[model samples]
Target: MDYPYPKTERQAELIALADALAGPIAARAATVDREGVFPYQNFRELHAAGYLGITIPRTLGGLGADVLEYALAHERIARACGSTALAANMHCSLIGRIDETGMWPAELLERVNRDIVANGALLNSANSEPDLGSPSREGLPSTTAERTPRGWLINGRKRWASLAPALTHMLVLATVVDGDSPPRRGNFLVPASSPGVRVEATWDNLGMRGTASDDVIFTGVEVPRDALVPIDGSATPGDGLGWSAFGGAAVFLGIGQAARDAAVHYALERKPNGMAGPIAELQTIQHRIAAIELDLLQARTLLYTTAEWWVARPAERGANMWRLAAAKYVVTNAVIRATDEALRVAGSAGLALTSPLQRYFRDARTAIGQPPLEDVALTTIGKAALGLSPGGNRDGAANHDAAVPVATVRSV
Candidate 1:
């Protein structure tokens, strides 16, 4: 009920900027999705408006607002454009993770922060491979990062490298192979223009088509020693992924709310012959709309509440992880259900490409399908609630994550 995030002047500026950034994108969301084209103009507006640096702290080039504010900003963008929102969510959130870690070279982090402020440079995980659906934590990667005299030589193909076209850098994750030490997997920060790096541009996606989530091939791509920056070298990996994951739900949930709003607008205006009133007067339509409204309220509150908790106490391991998993699981499904209901309320017209409802429905479906799949979350939660362990009661990683499937590509 009360304000959920910081009310600082910078936060207010970001809120105002986010509204401005969404305006033009809101006007073109449907067409961009239909044509599968990037919203460069919209991105420029956001870039110029400084929403791209919403997560960056003032000490850095960013406004440095709280996490909840970032999530709210994400919601604003997502309601206007799913692709842009998702891309910005990843970029704004990860910069702090790597920045705090003092992992990579200090010079590299400065360059990254500067690029994010000046050019809207984004960072995406080039971790997904053709063989592995979601890169396994414990799984051995086929793409090998071997240490060389010059630097790390990363060779592998990464699928679903979203935001490839607009990104200034790529965070490529590869397993290190060395005869000298025990196996350790490391994440590399490589510039988009490095040698032997190519985007296949095959972004034929079912949803969020404008994202430019193409397959990137890294053939002997060598990132200089400076590029293999690790946040862990500077900071622990604790709570980074969970905070980042739940942080984006507000955006997806807003999209569902947008779809619900659209359905309400149509219901209030459209009238059928002999029906004494607008579609809103009909009992069936009101019933369907009410269901969507409930989902929006429940999901949105959960998103912001959990976001606030993360901001207040990011390292509260048990509480943060459990609550975040619940929020991710709940809001994702809420969007799916809300979108489906919106389609039903809008009727056949909802299926038209010209209509925003159709785009909203499709994109919401894709958004919810993200990893830490709902089914897995339910299992993990159920296990956690009871005294039982997550997966392997013996080890925490096993309980939370399944054994990483070793991925090796065999020629088809």
Candidate 2:
């Protein structure tokens, strides 16, 4: 598919690269989903192609792609395999957050960036807990980080840790326990190979099964004091919702696009015994396809336009969080409907295990419950329109309690 939007030459090249990998990745997607296996080979190919460092700084040997570029590439990847794109989005969003926020110490940021550029290391935030649910809510993490003479000892279990099978580092959100002081939440950079860190194979899910989003148990895990990412109280805050919201919307949008294409192809070739021509001749099928195309176009337009607005007007992002939330909500729900329509178009054949439409259906539905969830997004938008305080830091207040992780919504 030709890129319809205007872009720089570098951006076009990067998008083309992503498109080139889509075919090979799609070839393995069915097998990966059928086996419920992590797409390690996909990540290897992505790393080799330097996509792992697409959002990192050029000074750090990365492609230094912006948010729009990231969205386009991610959408292309997701068009082939939702699982690979979703899991990889976690890593990319984390790195992009670090670059945008300067939330970590300079040394720590440099080290992590170098590792990603040189070794193809992957990182993801382990913020969701079984008990706490999503960290975006009011409660603090039950995961505790105790200060020790040597370093910090972490003890907690993180649920829905995407890319757990191959993570190089897990940025764990833990409540810091200090002597006689108020407990505070902090992010701990724990190496995947840490002595006490273990991955529990509990990621049996209905969709995006190749993500390996298992439970990561940190039992007496120890890391150096420097592992604690230094949160600067004075630095200008970056929009936590930008990359994840836009990138996630793109992923689901791609799934919808794939579903639409599959449906069109099926309609063109599926000829009934009594029919004069293919199902494509049916007005009902044509209507459904038209609806799918319309939804996809609207969703894509909103998503990309919001991303461009975000980059072009960084100063207004915090005040316009509702726009971001609306984009995500629209794209996610649009894809779900598109996939359903596509499945209807394919009839029983689409339900067969061999049909990719079923996978697309499942994957698209999975996005419904993701962060910036329907209720949350609607409430935020409603509040904003009412001239009320869009709570949860929608107005850009420094409320760490409502600080959402870069990868708040697990794709699985």
Candidate 3:
């Protein structure tokens, strides 16, 4: 698929690299999805294409692509395979957020950037805990780290850690020991080969089966003090959530477009006994395809435009996280609708195990459940429209006490 928006010479070149990888990625997607296995080959290809460190600074030997470029990559990769794109999103979003936000030490950031650029190391932030639900919501990770003379010893469990099987580095969110004010929340970056780190394969889902969002167990995992990155507990403060939302929107947009393409292809080839020609020749089929095209156009426009806006104004995003959430909500919802419509147009044949449309439908549904979930997005929009203040940050442990048990929505 051609890129939906205009790009700079560099952006167009980078996007071409991503587009070139789509074939092999799509070829492996079905088997990976069927077996529920991690797409290591896909990651290797992305790494070889220099996508793993695309967001890292050029000074640090990375592509130094902007937010729009990143989103375009996500959208294009996802067009071929949703699972591969989804897993890549976890790695890209985490690193992009760290680079853009600059909360950690310069040396530490440089080390991470060098690792990605030089060695093709993959990283993802593990924050979701089974007990407290979504980290973006009223939950702090129950993972705890103790102060050691060398550094910190981390021992805790993280659920839905995307790209776990392939992670070269993990940013573990944990509660730290404080004198008396309160237990501080810090993110500790631990190497994947650490003696105590374990990846438990627990991701067996109806959609995005190849993402490998399994459980990551940290048992006495040790990291230096420099590994601990400070986190501000406000929703609007960090760039991580915003970037992740954009990535999610891009994934669904691709999935939806794929579904439309599949349906149209099937319609053009399949002929019925009573009909004079293929389904595509029918007026009804033409109208349904037109509707799907309209949805794709609207969703793609919002997805790219918002990303460009963020690239143009990074400072305002910290205060306008709601806009990011809204974009995710709009594009994801549109994709889900497009997939459903495509299924209707394709008839029962689309539900066959051999059909890609069925897989697209399942993948698109998962988009609605990704971070800054639909309910949370709606709440944020409502609060903004009502002129209410976004709430103050609650300490990590304090949040656990008041957090009610809400339905867990996993993002991979």
Candidate 4:
């Protein structure tokens, strides 16, 4: 599991650490998936290994790694367990965004960094609602935060709350209501132990069951006025969605690589009843393996290249979002194709409960609906290629009213 690209000493070190933890994590993946339980033990290891604060700045007692390192480490972890990697991605992406964009207030940022560094506190954004769906779409949150005499009171039900089983804090998006003023969206930092915060067990799904991405109900959850982190509508120096897009791509690519490895191993060992040698000698098997490798090559190249470009060219990222979207689109679909081909290579054994390939297949399918889904990615790329703005109008005249802002929106 050598990294395919050049890396600094620090990046190599982090990747190696992730690889080291992957083996033990992979061993427990089967039971975690079977029982649909959260990988609490896996998180303990990750936290103890200092991966929980990998993205926070060094001054804040963290590794201060960038997006490339984050992507690389996540890929290694995902190669062992998609659920662990995906759930961790939620926490890492939030910290990554806060680090990349100096958007949060100094006190709030310091508090979050301290929690992660000192206590390995895990956090995630609660954005998607049952009715509003993904926040990436053009709709305001139905969740409301009213200004109270003492503080802000929040009330809403958020679905797909990943890491709900052990969240220390949740960045909740809610529409703010003030006296005689129009409603505005705000990102409120709500502690998990709030008086009215409750997690409902409703996350049984097709795959990634270990994520514990259940529903969280916030009823009259109160937070201080300082808890409200204002949303800046204007574009910033860093791309807010970079971590989500690249980190997610790496996870799926890792899953694809695992499938490819499984197929190769099985092919080299399985000898048919009448064959001269193992299935590795078969032309059809070789062709499928070739296809899997080709997909991996394409996906890795695009995903890593885009991530490097993002790190190298920060000032130009706002204009180059389509490239990030394209990487995600390509990696997810390539991984899915690779897994399907791997299953074909393994034949009946791939479908057995004892085989990890079936689990890989199910987990890979979950990547399709993550943020910047297929349709959304295609729409962004299509618009960019057609010389139109995000609003779908020509000549770069974007209709701000209709455009969806690129914020931190997570999926199950």
Q: Largest lDDT belongs to which candidate?
A: 4
Per-candidate TM vs. native?
0.89, 0.93, 0.90, 0.94
Q: Candidate 4 — worst ten consecutive residues by lDDT sum? A: 396-405
Runs in model 4 deviating more than 4 A are: 1-3, 231-238, 390-405
Compose the digit string of candidate 3's lDDT tens values, residues 174-217.
Answer: 88874464786677888999999999989999899999999999
TM-score of 3: 0.90
Q: In model 2, which range of ten residues has the least summed lDDT?
A: 398-407
Count of residue pairs whose backbone atoms collide, per candidate: 4, 0, 0, 0
lDDT of each: 0.71, 0.83, 0.78, 0.85
Clashes of 2: 0
Q: Report the lDDT tens digits of candidate 2 across residue range 1-412.
A: 3246646787688889999889899999999899989998899899989999988989888988888888988899998999999999989977887787776778878899999988989999888887886576646898999999988999998988999979999989899987888998888889999999999999988999999999999999989988888432424434445777787788899999999999999999999999999999999999999999988988988888888888888766555667778898899888999999999999999999999999999999889767877887887777766546442444544233333223253434
- Best-fitting candidate, scored by TM-score: 4
Model 2 local distance difference test score? 0.83
lDDT winner between candidates 2 and 4: 4
Model 4: how far is 50 from its true place, Å? 0.4
Instruction: Order the candidate numbers by lDDT, best to worst.
Output: 4, 2, 3, 1
Compared with the true structure, what per-residue lDDT tens digits does model 1 show for residues 1-412? 1244435665566666777778888888877787887678877777787777776667777877667777776777887888777766667667755554446566766778888888778776777777765554346666888888888898998877777777778888787865587767777888898889988878877788788778888899887666655644323324345336654676688689789888999899888898888989889999999899888788878878777666676445443255556787888888899999999998998888777888888888886456556665676566655526432343334234422112211100
Model 1 lowest lDDT segment of ten: 403-412
